[model samples]
Target: MKPLLLEIGTEELPVGALPGLAQALFDGVVDGLVKRGVAIERDDAKPLYSPRRLAVLLPGVAAEQPEQRSEVLGPYVNIALDAEGQPTRALQGFAAKAGVDWTRLERTTDNKGERFVHRAVTPGAATAALLPEVLAEAIAGMPIPKPMRWGTRDSGFARPVHWLVLLHGEDVVEAALFGVRSDRMSRGHRFMHEGPVWIAAPGDYVDALRAAHVLVDPDERRERIVREVREAARAVGGVARVDDGNLEQVNCLVEWPDAVTCSFDEEFLAVPAEALVATMETNQKFFPVLDEGGRLTPHFIGVANIESKDPAEIRKGYERVIRPRFADARFFFEEDLKQGLASMNEGLRTVTYQAKLGSVADKVARVAALAESIAPKVGVEPALARRAAELSKADLQSRLVNEFPELQGIAGRHYAAAAGEPAEIAAAIDEAWMPRFAADAIAPSPLGRTLTIAERLDTLAGGFRAGLKPTGNKDPFALRRNALALARTLVEAGIDLDLDAALEAAGADVAEVREFILDRLRHYYAEQGVPPQQFEAVAATHPQSPADFDRRLKAIAEFALLPEAEALAAANKRIRNILRKAEGAIPQRVDAALFAEDAERELAEAVDAAIADTDTALAQRDYVAVLGRLARLRPQVDAFFDQVMVNADDPAIRGNRLALLQRLADRLGSVAAIEHLSS
Candidate 1:
């Protein structure tokens, strides 16, 4: 057995390319080694890479592949025999091609009856001899997301291949790939170090590269980036609030990292802090600055490839980058405010919500009408709700939104105040899009909450009417997110809203959205370990309202608690079984005059009372109370089944019993289609 190492060195590759290429190289090598009959022990393997090199380290790979014996089917017995009962020319020819003598052939049965088969044993080849070919194919087969072709060869990669290293336990192994020859060399940090260093074996892969100024482990590189960046920011008495996503992108962009702090003009701070940070982190991948009071400062941090020979020169270069970005942001903010809330409202006329449904102006009108209609139901003044809805989407057309795009409603709030709008109106303008994600807080002001619901309802209804319902995991329109936000808003506001009524007022456009939300409830119930059928049953009856369906589902689940709930479920199953057997068979009458047993009369009376009580409770919306009362009839019903002959010779008696069973099923179904429950 011997340890092995293979490194593919190239010029600076994209930071994004390293992760996937490293994984592909590892998979390709392991698959190749296994195919060559090399046993790879767990303790003998490692795969790591930086931007400049991809390498695999394996210990104790077997010296040769295991030998195998296989049976090779040949000509049938009929074809192999001659007229004299001796082997024919065809049989001799088959044996010759198989490299076996006729006497060594074994007779066996084939699909057409008897046939001749030959046995051959293949001995494994030397591991060293197989390595070069396997390594060549695997490297050539590496799945680059997109590849290129360079030099005279047809092969293309993330970057042009410069060198290859293949080692077998400190001994050089000859392997060529994509027109490049194997060697023991690897390069280090693109700027700080250049040329190559010899790798002794798989064991020296990481430390050897480190000594040559490369940080090969991605995690170690990430930690170093974070630590040095924060330390550099702190030295300037400012905190570096680096967004997690930006930090990751920055980490991959460097090999040997240097954290650098820089400043910009303080006057640029007049632009909203959000736009400033977005420009820095998004466009430049720089960390933002925060003061002791938690306000954003006019400073930022960036990770540089090499520490500057002159610190002032680097700072000036960074300043040059942020100044233009800030200038554009400031211009957009001031221009958006000058348009005023009234002018922004006019721009909404040209914005289309959906192709088939009409423009955003049409949607705003529908939402405004719906909001006024729903406001009184939720205890908000109708005038206030209408006013809020009118202003909600006006900010969407603002110049600030035109520039940042992400700051739609946010910029609206600032502009509204600058234009001398009322405090409540300005707050509503901002709050309209209060929740943009799962963890975001819902809007709380009275008008703001009203406007939020109105907008979501309008979007949902319009999409539903347009036939773009969510399917499977494909919610391209984010309909589920809107539904979740609506549910959370209702619960948090402690507002008792009739979801069906609110949707109806939102307009006929979103009926499909309502159905989509109902479909989503099955997932919510399933995650709680409650059967989806239980939720479906409730939903089938109250599909328009999530709160109502949830209420009914909870009641049915609680009713399933009584000792006889399972028994009733079982009894209902039996009744269904009987009904299925008696398909198309009807009992025409249940003659009370033909009643012959006390159990029969008792069961009929119990069912009648349970039905009456269930009806009363249901009329009052007391679902749990109805379920509690229905459980009392289960025992009596079970007793009747035990004592009475349901298919009695007396026709009148049989009909009455059939009718009673139907009554029991009806009451149980009112709560839930109990027959649908799985045991």
Candidate 2:
């Protein structure tokens, strides 16, 4: 095995594009080597990057491709020879194409009968010999959204390539990549190092760059930035609010990181902290400082690319660049306050939510009505939920949200509180958009949860009505995400409202929207390790409420583990098939007197007793207990199928037997259609 390294040094890449570019290059190189019949050790390939370069290191790469064998099939043995069994032109022609003599070929038999075949073994090429094409292909396959050319060359890349380092152990791979010749030398930090750093081997790459003030490993740079920024915030008696996204972007923006403590005017702290933090983190890559109480402070930390000789001058530059952004945020906040949240919401009348779906004001009205109807079901005050729904979209008209769109819900919460609305109502304004993405938490307050459900229902109904349903990654209306969020909120939040009722309140087709929500539930449960058939078993019943659906699924999952579950499910499936084939509609009530066999008599008693025992459990929504009670009848169910035949000569007996089987199937399916669980 030999150690391998490939580096593409270029002009500074976009901070947002660096991570993706590095990952693409690494995957492409490993895939290239594997496709070429090269062996690589598990976990041996890894991506490394700084602002100016993307590199991949393979610690255990094979020195050459594995030797491969080729087989060429010729005409059948009978057709390849004359009646005397001598070589013919057909065999000769095959041998000539295979570069072998006719006598040297072997005869093999397969489904097609006997045939003459030629096999050849070729020596593998050295890894060095294949590096050129492999490197070129990997580079060409990079996901550069906007590639550009340099000088007079038509070739383009994410950025202009200045250096290429391709090393195999201690030797150069001898290749050209991105218009640069492969070599052992790599560029270092732009300001800290004056010349190229020589890599003696693939293993020496990281250490060589580190010594020249370039931390090529992105993880190392991120850790250093986080540590330095925290320490800098500590010096000013505050803690650094190091968001993961801001940290990642800052890590990609610098090769050598130096954290500098800076301060803005204390008056700027009067503005909403979100607006200030947004300006600092989004416009300028700076970590905001918060006091021990978790409130934004005047102090912030900025990571510089170079370790300046005079730290104060660098701090002044950081402070100077952020002042205007903060000032604008303060102005926007003060101006928005003058208009008040209520007056600003009136502007939604003119703003279009969707052309066919009417304006944002129309959506707000629909959501308010739905929230009002849903509040009583969820045990929240109807007036509070409706009020929250009304003001939810007011933030979209705020100047602060206009400048920073991420602050839409957050800004509304602030404005509502300032306008003297109830605190819960204020919180609901923001929490209405809770679970903005997957993996986020749902609304914690009952009022918030109600408003959230109402808002999503209206959007889903409007979108589906407008014919904007999702198809193949093109969910212009985000219906799939909306459905999941709606389902999750309903089930996980312990909200007991019927989903169909809520959909009807929003003017949506109850049956159509129910299936849409359940489809999303299928995907949602799949991630939780529930098999598709398990989901289908519960979904087959078509529960009208997500909470009801969730209960049935949980009960079915537990019941599936019981030893008797399989027999019961299979019996239920057989019962359903038998009923489908009956000549007429099966009677709801079975006549016990018409039973002609002892097995039929026993099954009727068992079904009656099971229903009597589980009636209370089913009514109480204790599906687990209900399914368990029904599972106890599995022995009787299996016996009935074994000893009794439903089609009797007497019509009265046949109809009674069919009614008995119908009862059994209904009792078993009350919780879920167990037949779908049968293998």
Best by lDDT: 2
The lDDT of model 2 is: 0.90
Q: How many clashing pairs per prediction, in order?
A: 4, 0
Query: What do the candidate models score in CA lDDT, each in turn?
Result: 0.77, 0.90
Query: For residues 446-512, could you state the per-residue lDDT of candidate 2 as single tens digits?
Result: 9989988999999999988898988897998889889999999999976777777778878888788
Which digits, one per residue and each the tens of the lDDT, describe model 1 over residues 1-679?
Answer: 7878888887766766677778777778889988766787647354677767787777667777888678888888888988777889989999999987898899888568998999878898777788888776676777677776787887678788889988888877877777888878877777777778778786787788878778777777788988988898788888889777788778767777788889888898888888898888888989987988878987888888776677778778888988888999999888877777888898878887788888888888988988887787567789878877788788788766777887877787787778777778778878878687756898978788788878778778777777776777887667888777776676467555777677777665445556666655566567779877577657656533455566678887887777877877778878867655653445554456767898888887887788776787887667899878887887787788899877788656666677767767767767666655547
> Considering only N, C-alpha and C atoms within 3 Å, which residue pairs clash in candidate 2?
none
TM-score of 2: 0.95
Q: What lDDT score goes with residue 534 in model 1?
A: 70
Off by over 4 Å in 2: 82-92
